[model samples]
Target chain A: MAGTAMTPYAQLVGPVDVYVAPYGTAEPAIDAAVPSTWYKLGPTTGDQTIEHSGDLEVFRDNDHQAPVKVTRPEEDLMVTFTVVDMTYEKYARIINNVGRIATGTSGSANVKRLGFKRGATPTEYALLLRGSADSPYGLYPGQNYIPRCVQSGNPAPARGKATRAELECEFMTLEDDTQSSDDDKMGWGTVQIN
Target chain B: MPMIDPIAAILKLISDNTNVQAIVGDRVAGKHKFAQAGSVNAWKADQSCIVAKDDPGTTPDIDIGDHVGRVELRCYGATPAAARKIYNSLIELIRDLEGRTTANTSNGTALIYSLVMDASPFTTVDPDLSIDMVVGYARYRIHEYALEEYQ
Candidate 1:
């Protein structure tokens, strides 16, 4: 009998969906139940880094050594995306949470700072990268909280040159201790491979 | 009646080549390792390896009991040049096995009739940069017979 042949399928065919929710709260699914706060990222590019550590042992008689135990130490997801709207309120909110925000009012003669604060208690979000819906092939990072973000760079405007603002955000996956069962600790954030 | 397992004999012959072993190791977890059909997805990016029996064709021969069939050798590589090198190495080894005989415990004996480069090697770049693959196919004919019974 002939061997089973693998059919070609598109693995990266859809736009990515980003969902935001308060920390220690229930996460929303990527389907029709997406929350209003969920925002689709503008064009983005990045990858996830899964770090692992291993212990090796060697014997006096054996010439080769092999790892005895391997463990995953950390997983970091980083992505860079262009800010779609400069005047959007979500931009201000994100900046307020991660950067310093200042507000001041000038009367007839002088102006003074009314309030200023640095972002604290970052919110968690889910990033869903969809493959073909017909097949199980997608990447979902469940309950990823942004640790840090920075503007890419400031470029001077010139003739025939276009400038687009971009932000590079780094995310770390956290275990959902709120879940009642240990099986749901990661909360379905994984690579979908059939 | 005793017969030689053609698949085992072919795999053994390919594994015995030192040059091939140096390029693609004998173990599956090696950087470049030999594989069977439908297992190419497991190979790492830019890895080079050989796959056997991907395509086979059998036909009847009046002179001999049966002309087993044409076995295909698929060579994969990260780059066109790397793939061509592996393909050439396989062709050289197959040519050396011409007119040779090998036996298997399950099967009796088999004679290698000839080796032919059925198709030229060609390169195809995968849109997914992770899986760029180059494939080449070769066909060989073998004659098999059961061991004769002594009265």
Candidate 2:
């Protein structure tokens, strides 16, 4: 059955589309959140200056030699991540079996949790917009937003033709609760990466 | 040289410059009152002498309290004014690493800038305000790569 029907390896790359509710597009909200006064120093030639002031501060420069810096006031907030854990899974039956035992019913199911780092700060993120992918939770259509996830690639099409789990994700945000402890300083959010 | 570790660099910076103190330990000592000295006389104990005994070894060592870590900064200069000036210069130097400036310049542009024609009376007398006039500087650093970079 192993004939010489070879195929080229596929590239694993795609834009990360991100979306937010209550807005048609996230770009406007992101732009509006940024302050107009924010700016970074420039280099001599062809130097790009990045400016931002939002719920989070932003800084950037074209050249690596001159790195952009953002200074937060003592009273201002700072966001940083604490690493959690990363896991890999390759079975849907196990997930279905567990679900059936817990819920007392099961038709079929899929489960995957990769790139799930504990306490991973979620302040900074790279979103690939302009895609038709939906969130992993399936809350939205596949034409709108793509949530965060870790990614691996499959080259051969003959490998069962089923989409393999690439990355796991956790969308987190800092909670505004005042009664929470230091470890819970970031609050908590849902994790939905497929 | 490139500091191998950032935290070490920060701690070293604080230690070398600031009069920082660290709390080492806290402990509880047992206290006991002794009475009936020798065969007849009983001992009356006060807060100060509740642990007195025939031999120094018989009683626990007196302890004031536990030590707590603290940091205090002291500046020196030609005069009090000069000390202040120097201190300020050092503070600004640290702030520089934090990408901060008192002049309010960011994003390679002037957030607040003005070309003043008239000199202040204070500056006019000195002609040039040197580190001799600075007292101290305080700064905090924030590190966040702009999302625009990825864009």
Candidate 3:
């Protein structure tokens, strides 16, 4: 008599691919094929961090030492990764699309420049992460989708060495009220193990 | 699991270079000093030659199976000036070492992602073997994905 078989091959373990597009769109990434308007943030140096957090309300009694119950009212989802492929577009995205590019001829040598300014508000994007599929866990590649996401924290790219200059960026998702269900508001994925 | 032969890769890096071949004339080989089945006289007939052998052990990435290793290069010639010529050719060859995918220069399953010399080539003596030789060390970084791609 055999029990549940170990499914190592079905485990989702590999590099995650990050993609981004404009916000408020119906579907930016369709059938795992990124649209022309979308941009794939190139090679990341290390692991992609997926974090899920929520505001917990603990009900405590005056006489009791421990809390009775804890309830979560709001939840947040964030993903962080370091992009190694240095490009004007990656810089602009980390800065929430404030930067712009222009070309000019400087003393007979054609030069392209990426320029940006301060006080500009952040921009929203439809973030898509294509992770490996977990067959036994019934998790698919296209399921992890965030309809509205905005970059969070300050981005500092350290330069120099045999190591490539990497821009570390973190993005937090916003609730998309247009969706019918709560699960569809932020994003959906089975990322837990018990 | 077959590992990459850094010695062969180093030898290929030298033998495949036109400038080095011009100096040593296809006499580049492994640490055997003579790969052909011949007597010591036959081996020394074309005394101007280059040989390479890898250092024992490796330093790999913590998680991934990428290997970081070193290879020692030996340049032998009949005269001191001739040995220096081979060393000079190696110096010129090292200019194009960065960002090289070993698939392009793989002589026999020796793959490398990148390479750089530890320092400038220096002179070494072998009175017993009786030859003028110069020695240098090259460090190489080989990624696991490159080997997986080959598989």
Candidate 4:
């Protein structure tokens, strides 16, 4: 499931995998091994979203109250997914981008800690989402790539009954000037479905 | 359009294995049949061959096509003992493919999400051809698409 061909019967499925790497990292093949530099950021809640947001501006003249021209002067690409588990690296980067991470034994006990600190900027990263789709022909697999982005969600864990805690992570994609291709400036993805 | 031909994908799985190919070579033919010679289907009585027959799998999802399917493989060898050996080697490969991808089949391909020997292979005599045979069943979760649909 690692080709670009698609058909009318194809249907995209959940965010099966998620990872983050450097801003200029190339999107990997569906079968390729996850590089050591990339950090796995999921077990998601299967409610992931990739959204194109912003408003379209409409221009109107007094002479023609109903006639006008509309243009989308601005837009944004955002990705959101609920991570169910708490991991050291994921929490550190999200909570305090400038936080210090340390690991040692408290006497005979093992311990790891994230020293929280205030920071003006979030760390930039290259995010990748590997997803699968179904088709009549065979398995269709591919990945979503955001060349550059920063975590925009500041969700905290909330406890509940009959429900599990989830960290709603969101990202705002930014233009990667280093990328030469137009489609890859913000984000891009394709599934080998159908 | 298919990623690769599905039948070819299955054939590739068997042909790609050095052990299986050493025994059957390009003899991993299609749909319970032997390979054809210049003009007609032919195989020597002592020659080895692996016959494949696909079944219409159970549909796992209606919206996004996926299948839990079966493929019956018949191993015909020079002797009954040899048939068991071929079956053992082939099953080893198939078992290893439980969570692996099939070579993009000619008609289509699939991620073999999970595979298991639904029916274990055993040495037997083919009633119709009187050939030494070992038959088995593979239950597979075809993640993307399957040749079963195309057939």
Candidate 5:
């Protein structure tokens, strides 16, 4: 008996939750591990790229026909999302890298001061993205990357328009030798496809 | 056979429990109210309430063909004691139903397997508290045959 062909609807859904661990920490199996703490980012999109190099070789026996050989490449993962809330905690990674934050309290007055300074050392961080709700899928970077804030947009206020800020970030994915299991190193991070 | 909405059945089960109703009263307008997911914003202070939201669940079991899913039930109250009381009552009610296979027939959904509390309820201060309020979350895993598998 022949079975009817049905469209596979196992597509990944949105409203991804982002988790971060200190740089250089070995990534845990994201599918089975719940992040200690995570921030929900949404109305978002994800992008991935693979960098490859190829060489052309011509042999006398091949009669001037060049054979192209391609090598497996590097993977790049990037995500851009808007940050509606401008709280210091929401921008901790960027602030910690590019600025200073002072914390103190006196006489029922709590103070949190954020300021920019030069010569601050750039910090790297490991990132993981999990699908929201009942979707059992996630994406993680194999290794920590020095996050570069490629773009930071100022909040724009307008008549009949909502004011929000945007942050564009890029991470250079690198091979992690710390992972002992080949299964852990499969794909860009340990993504759960089920 | 007609299917039952799991959320509705669970809510009805809670509503029918005398112990839960004694503390939280009737659905939305009671000493303690019950709402689903994002509707907890309407809950008032001094009123104990439980908010249920769907959680990311694990994969289905291959042998029994049952899919286990989690529901995060957040109990909120003006005081820690009140929150704990409501959470305890709900926990006991859930425990009492362990091994029971029959659903509220009125809800028309048969229980495929028992519902179990995944872990002990933990308390925390409400992050969005205007007044001092305590919140506790209990995770429950419900087992049911996946309809997609049948399809």
Candidate 6:
């Protein structure tokens, strides 16, 4: 998926329907639903600056051959998964970087086998499937979410694609989860970018 | 698994919305292209002629999945509001795209859109919220974009 604007990215064109499982008070987004919220941002005969915030850290791929980033919309009041801590441009660069790595930086998928085997034939990469996302950053104490980039790569062949299924692994969430965090609120209960 | 027809889906959306249907393809009068590919076509028939290419092998360079590339919807109507309405429909269509299937692989772009929808009246003031009325979507597309790969 090199140049193509995939799903989560595709969803960017319109309003997002976010379901925030609140831990305490109702999310500020609930108030955004009011028509008056748009008026405060700016003037509008038809369309004008309503309200927007840039670069909330949505998701990133740590296991990627290159860094990948995803961000919440620029509009502030929009209810979204995860929180708005980072900038959109920075997160966009990360996602673009993932595409760069996947496509060999030519804006295309690296379909040609570059002969970059991940590990030794006899030995296999270890997979850590977290039981749940109840840990420190997780949404709940025992809840879980699936992440695609949590794979292992070998030291050899710094830049190339490998057999993904061969390096498959899994990890579950830890127990004694505490306060309801962004993880649970965002459906990213178990996913960790690191 | 069933294949996704991105172009078809886009056209279906435009056709479904009467407001959009009234403005698309007729550059001289309609004023809205909605979702046009390549060069802008002068006539409605020419504009609506979307060809879905099935041969990924022939074009090994092109990303085959629906969520892999950018999707644009242009509007050239009497008002920006009309264009904005079409933009809203495109957004709705994208949501439908999510409903059709899940992400195919987590390895690709974390699907997202930078929606620049029309703003509502801005005379009233509210301080509780801070975001602009630009209107946008994110994770829903990302999660659904990756779903096609998981199945």
- Cα distance off (Å), candidate 5, residue B12: 15
What candidate 6 gets wrong by more than 4 Å, as runs, is: A1-81, A84-174, A177-194, B1-5, B17-67, B78-151
In candidate 5 the C-alpha lDDT for residue B100 amounts to 29
Docking class of 6: incorrect
All candidates: DockQ: 0.01, 0.01, 0.04, 0.04, 0.03, 0.11
* Of candidates 5 and 2, the better by lDDT: 5
Put down candidate 5 lDDT per residue, A122-153, tens digits, no spaces: 45555555532323221221221222212222
lDDT, each prediction: 0.44, 0.23, 0.66, 0.69, 0.46, 0.27
TM-score of chain B of each: 0.64, 0.23, 0.76, 0.76, 0.67, 0.32
What's the candidate order when arranged by decreasing TM-score?
4, 3, 5, 1, 6, 2
Task: Write out the backbone clash pairs for model 5.
Answer: B24-B32
Model 2 regions more than 4 Å off: A1-194, B1-11, B14-68, B93-151
TM-score: model 2 vs. ground truth: 0.17
lDDT of 5 by residue, B10-59 (tens): 66667678998887676422223323346754555667766665566545
Candidate 3 chain B superposition, TM-score? 0.76
Total residue pair clashes for candidate 2: 28
Deviation of model 2 at A52, angstroms:
26
Error of 6 at A103 (Å): 54
TM-score of each: 0.35, 0.17, 0.52, 0.53, 0.40, 0.24
Answer with 1 or 6, whichever has the higher TM-score. 1
Supply the global lDDT for candidate 2: 0.23
lDDT of 2 by residue, A98-146 (tens): 1122222334655443332322222222222222222233212122221
Report the lDDT tens digits of candidate 3 across residue range A35-79. Answer: 666678766867888799998999999999999899999788998
Task: Give the candidate number with the greatest lDDT.
Answer: 4
**Candidate 2: lDDT of A122?**
24
Interface RMSD of each: 21.1, 22.0, 12.8, 8.9, 12.1, 9.9
Kindly give the stretch of ten consecutive residues in candidate 6 chain A with the minimal lDDT sum: A39-48
Error of 6 at A147 (Å): 18
Candidate 1 structure quality by residue, lDDT tens digits, B1-151: 5544555556556666787777656522213342334685455556777666635555544543334455555556667677677767777875554232343434544434444556766666545443444555555444444322210
Q: How far in Å is the alpha carbon of A156 misplaced in model 4? A: 1.3
